[model samples]
Target: MAPAARRTRPSPGPGAVGTGPAGEPVHPAEPVPFAARVVGWVLAVGGGIGALAAFVLTVEKINLIADPGYRPTCSINPILSCGSVMTTPQAEVFGFPNPLLGIAGFSVVTTIGVLVLAGARLPRWVWLGLQAGATFGVVFVHWLVYQSLYRIGALCPYCMVVWVVMIAIFWYVTLHNLHHRHLPVPGAAGRGVDALVRLHTVGLTVWFLVIVGLIGEAFWFYWRTLL
Candidate 1:
């Protein structure tokens, strides 16, 4: 007879891959990528900055209300004067400086961005809240742009920065929300927007270009008036 066969134990079960005796996976959780983490942090920082800027502008508006000559730092040029916009009756819609609304709205956005950056798995409702706030911000920014171009007859540089930041935040948040299906838009409207964002890169580029063109046209008109 051949030598006595030596028996060897078979490998552990399917659950044994990198697992312990409890059959649970023992590998450390994969870390988020540096690029993604950086992007999230940037969003958070941008939101915080936007919120602070809006708050300061609101405070300045308050001071101006107290003293008409209390011009803020934004009173730089005729075309870029917060004083011009603030003194307008439109700024007092609902009997308050509109920047106060921006302050409050951006504060909420900053909070959401911070929580997202911190890797908090926010609930769907929380994402929906952010979407609502961002949507409102987009609407308000457009209203301000309309006021600056048509009503106020002037554009505040600081206000323009705020508008740009608001747009960026809106785009970023909306894109994220769509990717996660957190938007409340339903049926065709929702599907259409999602398809447009997903399928038409050139369309989005053109849309952004159109916004820049409008702003440039306004600047050109103002510059020509100066000449």
Candidate 2:
């Protein structure tokens, strides 16, 4: 019989599957989705705009607080009064204008958003940090709204912009955290929040509409009194 045919094996190319020295197979990296990229870009741009707006408003509030008569460049009317809101003790929750907090908080958020938009793959800890910051902002904005409506008896247009933007940022961050499983919420709570988000886009819209309606009603009452 002829000599046994010599055995031969093909070498692996760059695209081929390969084994490590320990004989473990290496897998390829997964691609990120186009929708996620678009969302990142949107968050970056929106966060930047919100941060700039908050910074300007904070500066105006500081000036108004320091000098009561200092007229802001954007003060258009008695109803649209930054000065009225800024002068209130409620504006100084910690003996300083609340917008200062917004300026600092939003600056961090804007930086994160920009990095994400630039294709940075943030770790879980970073996402958790964003969630914590956003939760605090949302709670703080609601507190301001309560003060504006009930205690201060005045509304600030710039303040409203901050409120709305903060709400948007909070919602966006919450959604992202849930989708990426970055939140530390426990089993039942996490499932519940996720269920609410997944099942109730319309409910979220309606909830927002109700908030706007309440604000609109308050504005209508204020306008009626002025008129």
TM-score of each: 0.73, 0.74
Least accurate stretch of 10 residues (summed lDDT) in model 1?
Answer: 33-42
lDDT of 1 by residue, 42-131 (tens): 467767777777788888887987898787788888777888887888777778777777777777777767777787777888767777
Which pairs clash inside model 1?
none
Deviation of model 2 at 22, angstroms: 31
Clashes of each: 0, 0
Per-residue lDDT of model 2, residues 43-97, tens digit only? 6765666777778887887687688789986677766777777777787889777
lDDT of each: 0.72, 0.73
